[model samples]
Target: MNKAILIGRLTRDIDLKYTQGGMAIGRFTLAINRKMTREKKQEAERNNQPTADFIGCIAFGKTAETLSNYVGKGNQIGIEGHIQTGSYENKEGQRVYTTDVIVDGFTFIDSKNKNGGDSEVQDESYDGFYPTDNDDIPF
Candidate 1:
């Protein structure tokens, strides 16, 4: 029941690392733009308020490896995950609360470039029926 769906751009390149057991872990930040009216946006802009929320995210195993290999800063992606919360004692002897989205799955929302360009994905291996002409239709 605790699920989170987010669509945003990466704030930086994913930091990929491995555990002592050799399991891969990746950490990244996502920048999600806030939804607002024109007037509200203008007001916030004038006040220098942030228009985007930066969220911390983490991935594991194959997901982590895929993210590190294919995605980078400025690339948009859609992620499905759950929110995790914890607290730890830092070097300063202060309790630091942390929240992160543990990614379960993700999809690319951007094409080949960060500037937004149109591209086509040609999957030649598809086996689905594609009628090249009207004569190929059975119905």
Candidate 2:
């Protein structure tokens, strides 16, 4: 049914733009970390490490503007979307294929107060641990 889900941190702030018809569009990259683990059959096979994969996503319409306004670099979010693919010719006449997710929905997953310094102060307004535009905290 062409559905995909991702939970990751934003690599940078969302880039907001408009189409020729004035529809808003936002683009961003997400960095998802995968924990690598090795199982040991003997006494020397236990190995664990962390790796990350970055992905591109796009959002359209009011959702796009909202995401751009509220989200920033390093914010963790959950995305639900579908995969889209396209191809284009470069200056050298080489064909380039691109793939990205067209986001349908998303949610904030990071704690209200990141960096672990002021959990209590941040939690005072942490409804679902997500900060709203109406919140008093400065972004």
Candidate 3:
């Protein structure tokens, strides 16, 4: 019942770290754009305002590693998870509230190769065949 899904670009690179117990955690910000209706668009233009929401997200374990290694700022991705809310006391003695999407799944939205592929699309076929650009059959 607490599920949420989002598709957006990374506001910045993912921050990956590990705990003393070696648990991996990653944090990132996503910039999600709101659909602009004609009226809203006009209002935004008049106000010179942005029409996007920045969301905080967190992932764990291999997911964290994957995101940290392969994702970067401006990279578009699809995310699915639940919203988590918490509060912590800061040094100022004020209670700081926090909300984040605890990411459960992520999808790569760009087809452009993260790893710049060779001149030829080099890949291994499902049948255990390595295909090269020179090959008459595509990989």
Candidate 4:
């Protein structure tokens, strides 16, 4: 019952690291734009402001390595996970609250890019389906 779904763009490049036990861990930030009503959009336009929410996400194990390897800044992604919250004390004796979506699954929503940072996943070897045409897609 603690599920969270988020669709957003990567605010920055993904961070990939490993735990002492050799577990892969990836951390990234997503900038999700808030959907606004017409009134809200007009108000925001008048105010000249931005309407995006940046969220922190963490992935472990194979999921961690997969995300880090495939995407970088400006890539759009969709994630499904649960919210996790914790607090830690800072050097100034202040409590730092942290919230993150511990991702269980995700999808790459960006088109395949040939740039160096993001590698092109082989189509024949990929098990996931990538449609070659818009036909047969049931809307």
Top TM-score model? 1
> Local distance difference test, per candidate?
0.90, 0.83, 0.87, 0.87
Q: What is the Cα-based lDDT of residue 33 in candidate 4? A: 84
Descending-lDDT candidate ranking: 1, 4, 3, 2
- Runs of candidate 3 exceeding 4 Å displacement: 111-139
Better of 2 and 3 by lDDT: 3
Candidate 2 differs from the real structure by a C-alpha RMSD in angstroms, to one decimal, of 8.4
Between prediction 1 and prediction 3, the one with superior TM-score is 1
Q: Could you tell me every candidate's TM-score relative to the true structure?
A: 0.82, 0.72, 0.77, 0.75
TM-score of 1: 0.82
Q: Across residues 1-139, which tens digit of lDDT does each residue of candidate 3 receive?
A: 9998999999888999999999899999999988989899789979999888999999999999998888887788899999999999999999999999999999988433557542124453534465456667675
lDDT of residue 22 for candidate 3 = 96
Residues 1-139, candidate 4: write the lDDT tens digits. Answer: 8999999999877899988999999999999988998889788878988777899999999998988888878888999999999999999999999999999999988844646333445555555676575677777
How close to the true structure is residue 85 of candidate 3, measured as C-alpha lDDT? 100
lDDT of 2 by residue, 7-109 (tens): 9999989999999999999999999976544333222333333366789999999989988977788778899999999999999999999999999999877
Q: Can you give the lDDT of residue 51 in candidate 3?
A: 84
TM-score, predicted candidate 2 vs. hidden true structure: 0.72
Query: Which lDDT value does model 3 have at 77?
Result: 88
Q: Candidate 3, TM-score vs. the true structure?
A: 0.77
